[model samples]
Target chain A: MDDKIKMKVQELLQSGKIKGFLGLRERHGQVGPYLFTDGDDLEGLVVGDRFKPGDSRYPLNKQLMKITRGDPSGCYGVLVRGCDERGLKTLFGSGQIKSEQVVPVGIACPQDLADACECLKPYPDERVAGEAAEPRSFATVAKVEAMELDERFRLWLAEFSKCIKCYGCRNICPMCYCSECTLENKDFGDIGSLPAENPVFHLTRAIHMAGRCIDCGLCNEVCPADIPLRTLYKKIADIVEEEFHCRPGYGSPETPPGLNIRGEELKH
Target chain B: MEYRTVLTTCTYCGCGCGLYLEVMDGRLVGTIPCKTNPVNEGKLCVKGWNVHEFVQSPKRLTRPLLRKNRELTPVSWDEALDFTAARLREIKEAHGSDSIAFLASAKVTNEENYLIQKFARAAVGTNNVDHCARL
Candidate 1:
C-alpha cells in the first residue's frame, strides 16, 4: 500500500467521514470487491496489480446510490478512477445516485492499463493514489474512423458477428446499472439466439450510450468476440459533439443537453 | 453527495431522442433515457446509447498525418492541406474533373458539409459529392 493512500484512508476512517470503504481485495489470487469498516486494516489495503474485480468493471453508481438512500444524512466514500468518476456523474445526473451522500477516493491508473483498455483519461479529477497522466489518444478508434464507410461497416460486422451473446459487455459496464436492460428484453433483442441480432443489438447499446458512455472501454474488454465496441461508440460521441456541441458532463447540470432531447430541441 | 438526472437529447443521428447522462464527481460515466421525452420515450437506438464513449476515447486523432513513401508520418496540418490541394489539382489536370469524387462524412457539421459540396462543385469542377450516410 502506498503510504499516502494508507494515511488518507486512515484519516477518512478516523474522521468518521465514511462508514466504510468498498474496494478490491485479493482473495485466493483473484481480486474481489471488499468492504472496509475501519482504517485498522490498512495492511490488507494493497492495490493488487493484475487484479480487477467484476464490481470495478461495472458502473456501480446505482449500488452506491442504494447505500446512501436509507440514511439521508450519512456520507459514504468509494474508490473512483476516471471511468468511475464519469459513471458517478452520469448516475448523479440521471437521478440514480446522490452526489452529496458520497465521497470519492480517486486513483490514477498507469499507461499500460490505459492502452490495454483503450482508455482516454486514466486519471480522476482528484487522486489519493498514484500520479496522473495526460489523457491518451484513441488510435485504434481513429484507424477505424479513417476507413471508408463500407470498410468500417464491414469491419464492425465481422467483429460483431463473433458475439456469443454473453452480455459481458453490459455486465462489465459500470454504466450499465439497470436492473432490467432492453438488450435483455425478449421482444427487443429476443432470446436463445446465442449470437443475438448482428447490428441491432449492438446498435441498441451504442444509442443507449449517447451522452453517457464515459469512454471507459470496458465494453470492449468484456466482449468475448473482442469486438472493437469502443470505436463505434467513440464515433457516435464524435457525431454528437459535432452536431450538438454538447459534452455530457462538461456542461451545466441544470440543462439537459446532448442527444437526450427531442422536438424543439432540434436546431434544424 | 448530490446526484440527479436532467433530461437531454441524443446527438448521434437525425432522429433526436431523449436520454439522461449520469454524472458523479463532476465526471461523465453512463446514460439513461428520459421517460418524458417524446422522441425516445425512454427508448434509445444503439448509437444514442453509446454516445459518451468518444469524448475521452484513446483513439481520437489530435494531429494530422500524411503518407510518406507508403508510411503514415505525423505532419503539420498546413503541410497535409497543401499536399492534398496539390495532389487534387494534379489529378484534375491529368484526368479531367470527373476523375475524382468527393466523399463527405455524416460526422461533420452541416456548415462543413455545405462548404465541402461547394468546394467540390466550384473548385473541383465536379458535382460528384456524396455522403457516407447515403451508403
Candidate 2:
C-alpha cells in the first residue's frame, strides 16, 4: 500500500516510458497481479500488503516473463521486491530475459516480512519506497543443521512424504522457465501417481535449485502440503556459495550460474 | 495487452480447489492456486497446477471415435451412442449384465459419475460399477 509506487507507475505510463506497468492491484477486496496500461488506472495499486505487511505476495517477475514472452519487443515496468530483484537477476543470468527489457520499481520489504523470510538482503539495490531493514540470518537452515544426522533424515523424509505431487512450487517459480521440466518426465518421475518416491523427488528438485534458486520463499508459501522447500533450496544455494564463492541473483550475467562471482563477493 | 488471472475451480476432481487461471490476451496460459480459498488454502495437486494444459491440448478429443475394422474412426454422436447401446444390449442378452463393467473417472464431474452409476444399476441391470480413482 505505497503511494510512491503508484505515482511512479502513473508517471511512467503517462510519459510513454513503458507499454505497461506490472504490479499488484486491489480490486473488490482482493489483491492480485495486474497490468496497468493506462496511467489513470493507478487507484488500486499496492505492494502486496492487504492484511499483513507483504502477506499477499505473487510472483510478479514470473508474470513479467509471461507477458514478455507474449510480446517480446515491448519494454515494460515491473514491481520488484528484494526477492523479485534477485529473481530478475537470475533470469537475466540464465538468458531468459534482458535487464533492459524491464524497468524494476524496486521497494524494500518491511522488517517483519524480512524476518518472516529470514532474508539476508531485505532491500533491493535501488529502492523507490520503504527504508532499508536489518538483514536476517538464515536461521531456518541452521535450525535443520542443528539436528542430528538421523533426526534430519527422518525429518526431511517425513516432510517430503507430505508432497501431493503438486507442481505449485515450480509453476510459481520466477526462475523456472524450462520448456521441459525434469520433474514431469514420465520415465523416471512417474509423474502422475501419488505417494511420491519420497526423498528422490524433493532431493531432485533441490539439486536443480543449486546455482539457480534466489532463496525466494514462494515455494514454501504456495505448497499445499506445508513442505519447507525454501529451506531445501536455501541450503543448496548456501552450499554453492560456500564452494564457489558465487551466489545466484547477485552477479553479472556473463558466467555460468555456478561460476558467477559477484564483485563484492570477490572482495570477500 | 490484457493480462489477468481469472479465479476458477479446478475441474480435475471433486475437491473443487479454487485456482486462478492466467489469461493473457484471452488465452489460458497457466494456473495458480487461490491463496484465500478455504478449500485448498493455496495448495494445488499436480493436476490442479496443470488444469490449463487439458483445455488447449492438441490431443484432446473433440469428436467421438468408434472402432471400425479394428481402427478407431471418427463417428457422429448419435452413431456412437447407438453403437454402444446396441453392443451393450447384445452382450447383456448373450451373457449376464454383470459381465459389462462400468468404470467411472475422477476427471468427470460428480453428476456424471452419479448418472454413470445410475445407468449401470437401473438401465443396464448391473452392479459392477467402479471408479478409476479406486484403481
Candidate 3:
C-alpha cells in the first residue's frame, strides 16, 4: 500500500503534474505531514501508519489550505483518506480551498480504522490502495440520543467540565478558518478562563460545525480531558443529514462541495 | 515549497508540552502536538496551540521600553539595561534586597530564567526570586 502511494506521488512529482505532493513522511520515528517537491525525496513517504494501520494521521488538507491560501493557482497532489476527502470537500464548499488547485491522492481506510471511526463511508471516490470497507454508523451518537434531555445535559456538562480552555478542537479543525472567531468575543464564553462555560464553548463550536464537521475524531484524540467532542458534532451531523438531507463531504467529483440544502427553503 | 514541523517544547509554561511548529516557506504557520511525547500525550493548552501567533503579531514588543516621565518610551538596549541596573542598586541600598524581588517569565529559555534568579540571589543578595509558572 505504501509502495503504491509512493509510486503515485513520485509520478505526480516527476511528471510535473503537481507542484508538490502533500503527504506524510516518517522522520525520527515520527510520521508527520510533509510536502514533497522532488520525486527522489520520497524515501520515507508513508500512508500515516506507524504501528497499527491508519493510526498516525495528520490534517493534510488543513496544511494544504494553509500553504495554498496564499497562492491558489498552483495544483498540488494531496494524500487523503475518506475523512480527509470529506474535510477537503467541506473546505471546497466553504470556499476555503479550490478543487482545481488540488488533486486528491485518495486511499481507502482499512476496516479496523473504519470500524473504529464508525464511519458512514470509509472509502474516497478514487483510491490507490486498500479495499473499500463496509460503512458503519455512530454508536456513540446513538447512545447519547437514547438518553433523556436532562441526563444528556448533565452528561455533556460533566464532559465539558474537563475542558482546559485549550482550543485544540477548534485549532485542529480543517474547516475552521475564521479569522475573527465569535469565541474570542466578550459576549461569548470566557476565553481564557479554565473550566470553560458549561456547553457554551463546545455548543458554539458544535453549532458552527453543523454542515461542516467531517467526523475526523481528531477532537476526541487531542482532548486531554477525554471529552467526547466527536459524539456531540456527530449528533449535529445527524441533525443536518436528517433535516436538510445534506452531508458536507459526500459528493461526486464534478459537484465536489454539494451543499444542496438551501437555507432559503426553510419555512420556519 | 518547503514545509516541515520542527519539534520543540512549549515555552508558555514549564509543563513543557512537546509540540511541532509547522513552518511553511520559512514562515510559521501553526502548531501541532507531538503525539509520542509522554508529557502531554498529544495535548496542549490554549497558549500552546496559539504559540505561533505571538511570533508574527504586530503588537508584539520588538525593542526594550523604559518609563520616562510616567510614560513608556522606546529605548536602546544599553540605556534600558543601565537604567534598570542603577534603579536596582538604589532600591537595594534604600529598601534592602528582599524589597526588590525578581520575577521570571515562562516565555524565555531556562538558561535566561536561571540568569534572572542568579541576578537576584548573587547581585542583589535576595532569595526572593520567583517564577510566573512556579508550582
Q: Which candidate is the best by DockQ?
A: 3
Model 3 chain A, poorest ten-residue lDDT window? A259-268
Model 1: what TM-score? Answer: 0.59
> What DockQ do you compute for every candidate structure?
0.01, 0.50, 0.58
Error of 3 at A268 (Å): 35
lDDT of 2 at A110: 89
Q: What is the lDDT of residue B52 in candidate 1?
A: 63
Error of 3 at A2 (Å): 2.2
Among all windows of ten consecutive residues in candidate 2 chain B, which has the lowest summed lDDT? B33-42
Question: What tens digits encode model 2's per-residue C-alpha lDDT throughout A1-268?
Answer: 3789988888888888789998877765556787888877788788887677777788888888888778777889999988888888878766677677789999999899999999988888987999889999889899999999999999999999988887888888887777778898887677778888889888988887878788779899899789999988999989998988887877655555447432211110
CA lDDT, every model vs. true structure? 0.66, 0.83, 0.82
Q: TM-score order of candidates, best first? A: 3, 2, 1
Off by over 4 Å in 2: A26-30, A39-41, A184-194, A251-268, B66-71, B78-135
Candidate 3 Cα errors over 4 Å, as ranges = A190-194, A253-268, B1-4
| Top candidate (lDDT) | 2
Model 3 residue A72 CA deviation (Å) reads 1.6
CAPRI verdict on model 3?
medium
Off by over 4 Å in 1: A51-62, A69-73, A250-268, B1-135
Model 3, B89-134: lDDT tens digits are 9998999989998889987888999998988898899998787877
